[model samples]
Target: MPRSIDSFNRQRLITSYFSVTLSITLVLFLLGFFCFLVLSTQKIANHFKEQVAVTILIKDNAKSADIAQLQKTLSVAAFVKSLQFISKEEAAEKFSKDIGEDFVTFIGTNPLQNAIDLSLKAEYAEPEKLGEIKRELEQNSFVSEVIYDQSLVALIHENVNRIGLITLVFSALFTFVSVLLINASIRLSIYSKRFIIKTMQLVGATRSFIRRPFIRLNVRLGILSAFIAMLLFSLSLWGIVKSYPEFSILVDAWILLWVFLGILVMGILISWGSTYFATQRFLNLKTNALYY
Candidate 1:
């Protein structure tokens, strides 16, 4: 009968350990997912912004040699991410297809000007930098006009700022919740061993000696939970990329590094710190307080 009772208690302890480990793992996973979204938002936004182009209309009588020279100069410019020269013939063909009519046929000549389409780097996509780029390009003798959506650029900046603020606020809020949940879970797990901590105190064991083993055990659990969270995050990222192959470009090594690092830090910090504090509570508590 005594052996049967011992077996029952051992099974219960094992179940409790599993439950606490699972709880911490899930909390870590949630924190990791939040960081992934916060980090990748900028990259996704930049991808959309890079599609906005600034068109440079060339002068009607500009020599081909001068156009080639201008292209070379623009290619090396700091603000230009990419540039493509569209000849009048190519522009006319595209315009014709868009309108479903050949304007050159009715006009007896192509009316469209040769143009260079410039896509600025993400940093230079702002209205102020775009204005500077426009002014600089317009100074060229062979360039007739530089055109882009100024209002659209302003809107993009405004929207980006709003998104950043929202993400920051949510991150702070979620982080606090994650820490609380993890700390509570750790405390509950330690609460189960309140009697054991008291026993060690009665045996003349040093506080550090008692804490040393619990801290080591909890830190190991934290590391394991971190690994599990990272595995789940990786699978989630892979599934997203597989479903929408177009967004694969946004899956950068640096982002992954930061996310994994964050998960590990969160897991270790919360688990180790929570275990330390929780253990201290029981260590300092009177024997009668253990009943609660």
Candidate 2:
């Protein structure tokens, strides 16, 4: 009878520990995922921003040498991500293909002007910055006009800001919920061993001594749970990269390393703190209070 009861209690203890570790792992994974989203928000925004192009129209009478000089100047500009020079002939050909008719033949002349299609870096894809760039380019002697989709630029900027704010709010709320969940799991795991805590205290065990073993065990649980969470997080990232290969550019090794380290630290701190406090509560309870 004694051996059977011992076996049952041991199995229950193992089950309890497993449950606590799994709970903590899941919570940590969610927290890590939110952190990754917050960090990658800017990178995702920049990818969209760089897709819009600004067109610089060239004067019809501009000399080849002057056009070449202008191209060189724009190539070296801080705001320019990339630029492509389109000749009048090439532009007219592309337009004709788009409209499925030879407009140049109907007009008896190629009416399209030579232009440079400019792709600005993500940071400069703002209304104010684009306006400044347009004004700057229009001042050049060989440039006739500089134009881009101002409405599109404004829309992208607005949407990116809105999404970033929403993501930040969600991340903060999720972090708070994660902490509470991990704390509760740790407290329940300790609650199952309250009698052991009180028994040791009754047998002349000091408070610090009683806490030391629980703290050490919970810390180890935290480390193990953190590793498992990191593994799940990494698998999720791998799945994302596999589905949308373009997003692979946003995955920075250094940033991911820091995020994983943060997760590990959070797990350790929360577990240790929870275990310490939970054990302290039981230690403070009187002998009669142990039943309730």
Best by lDDT, which number?
A: 2
Q: List per-prediction Cα lDDT, in the order shown.
A: 0.90, 0.93
lDDT of 1 by residue, 1-292 (tens): 9999999999998887787788889998989988987998899779767877999999889999999999999899888899999988999999899999988998999878999999988889998989998999899999999999989999998898899789978988999999999899889988989999999999999999999888898888888989998999899889989999997976999999999999999898899999999999999999999997
The residue pairs that clash in candidate 1, if any, are none
Q: Give lDDT tens digits, candidate 2, residues 1-292.
A: 9999999999998998899999999999999988888888988899999999999999899999999998899899999999999999999999999999999999999989999999999999999999999998888887999989999999999999999999999999998898899889989988888999999999999999999999999999999999999999999999999999987987998769977998899899999998999999999999889888
The runs of at least 3 residues in candidate 1 whose Cα sits more than 4 Å from the true structure, single-residue gaps closed, are none
lDDT score of residue 78 within candidate 2: 99
What's the CA error at residue 142 for candidate 1, in Å? 1.8
What's the lDDT for candidate 2?
A: 0.93
TM-score of each: 0.96, 0.94
RMSD of each candidate?
A: 1.4, 1.6
Q: Could you tell me the lDDT of residue 164 within candidate 1?
A: 79
